[model samples]
Target chain A: EAGVAQSPRYKIIEKRQSVAFWCNPISGHATLYWYQQILGQGPKLLIQFQNNGVVDDSQLPKDRFSAERLKGVDSTLKIQPAKLEDSAVYLCASSLGGVRGTSNYGYTFGSGTRLTVV
Target chain B: AQSVSQHNHHVILSEAASLELGCNYSYGGTVNLFWYVQYPGQHLQLLLKYFSGDPLVKGIKGFEAEFIKSKFSFNLRKPSVQWSDTAEYFCAVKAYNTDKLIFGTGTRLQVFP
Candidate 1:
């Protein structure tokens, strides 16, 4: 099976600029997640989608960050008026839902988009 | 709020040396534990997971982790590590009712051959 796919392996933008990252989850996966990993820090969950509907977005900075998983397959995360603190690796992952007693619940991650703010 | 902690920020070791990385989580409910490894310029990969059954779970590349419920810890270990084992390891926890995975700050390991 193919792994999760993300576009624009790297990106650079000035502060207050806008940027968007795209992700395509593994086929048949029903759950998708977006995480931001800062330097010297662990990855933090930004948003989660169960199929096309959002399951969680409590950590997402709605004022600047917005994400959507349309058609329950591809996802897009947009950061408008990006700030210096937004420079980090944006990772996308997929799973087969949280089904117990099964080995399909673990997530498969993408290479991630490394964003740099100038 | 649930959180994960990795006390070791960095570690250096010579080849064939035993390795241990500490990970602890603060959660009072049923949870799932996992260890993930990220090689240089690579995506995060699952090292091991402890959902239930045995407390000692073995993973790929000869890595293993012991889940101690009483201590709220899942420490990763390897009897003998190689230079190829150099990478960043992250510990994550997910509560039984939530799909969110709380991750700990990664521990970077540099193994010299």
Candidate 2:
């Protein structure tokens, strides 16, 4: 089975410019997530999608960041007028929805889009 | 609020050496713990997880973690590590009732042959 797929593995943009990352999750997965990983840091949750509806987006910066999971199969995360602090790897992950007996079943992540804002 | 912390930022070791990485979280309520590994040029993958039952959980590639609820710690360990085991490890936690995860700054392991 194919794993989560992300496009534009690397991106370079200037401050104040716009950038977007795309993701295609594993087949049949109902939960999708977007995360930001600054250099030397772990991935931080930015948003989550359950089917076509958003499950959580408490960490998302509403002023500059936006994401959409149009059909529940693919997602796009956008940062308008990016800032230097936005330089990080944008990771996408997916998991089978519903509850795992204990925790939710493990998540499968994409290789990530490395964004460099100059 | 839930937060996770990794004690070590970076570690260097020779191949075949033992490995232990410490992780702790602050949460008054119950929690679920996880350990994830990211090899160079790779995505994060689950190494192991702990929810209930045994405090000790074994995962793939000989990796294991012991979850201590009293101390709010879930430390990953490997008795013998190969150069292939060199990677960045992250510790994460979620509240007992939620699926949202809070992650710590990762620990980078460098294994020299």
Candidate 3:
């Protein structure tokens, strides 16, 4: 079984520029998530999706960030007009959600995309 | 709001030494807990978890954690450490019946050979 996969392992952009990151979750997983990990800090949830619908995105910076999981499969997260603070690692994870015995099973994460804003 | 806490920012130990890392959480309702490890340049992987029943839960790679409801603590412990165990460890918490996870700041463990 393959783990979650992410694209463009690294990216660099100027402030105010737009950047997008992609994620492909495990084949049968129903729950997908995106997190932002700033340097020296832990990963913070930016958004979550259950199938094709969003489960939660309260922490997402709506003013500059957006994400979508289309057809209940792969998903994409975009950050426009990036800020210097947006320079951080973006990680994607997936889990077999809501299954009586599997809901508590932890997520499998991607290698993550490291983004830098100058 | 639910939140997780890891008291140690970094820990260094020699191979074959006992290891313990602290984790605490602030949540009013029933919750689930987990410990995840990320080796250098690798993705975060589950080390252990506690859902219900037994307070002590064992996980992959010979790691285990004890959940103490009274103290609101879930601390990771390894009887003996190895160089292979050098990694960053994070404690995460999720409300029971919810999918969202709150994570700790993480503790970097360096096991010296």
Return the top candidate by TM-score: 1
For model 2 chain B, give the 10-residue run with minimal summed lDDT. B94-103
Regarding lDDT, does 2 or 3 come out ahead? 3
lDDT of candidate 3 over B5-113, digit per residue (tens) = 9999999999999999999999989998999999999889989888899999999989999999999999999999999999999999988868888899999999999
| Candidate 1: Cα lDDT at B92 | 97
Q: For residues B30-110, write the lDDT of model 1, one tens digit per residue.
A: 899999999999999999998989999999999999999999999999999999999999999998777788899999999
Chain B TM-score in candidate 3, rounded to 2 decimals? 0.98
Give model 3's share of reference contacts. 0.59
Model 3: how far is A67 from its true place, Å? 0.5
What's the C-alpha lDDT at position B110 in model 2? 96
Q: Model 2 TM-score? A: 0.95
All models, DockQ values?
A: 0.62, 0.61, 0.60
Clash counts per candidate, in order, are 0, 0, 0
| Angstrom error at residue A24, model 2 | 0.9
lDDT of 3: 0.93
| Candidate 1 C-alpha error for residue A97, in Å | 0.8
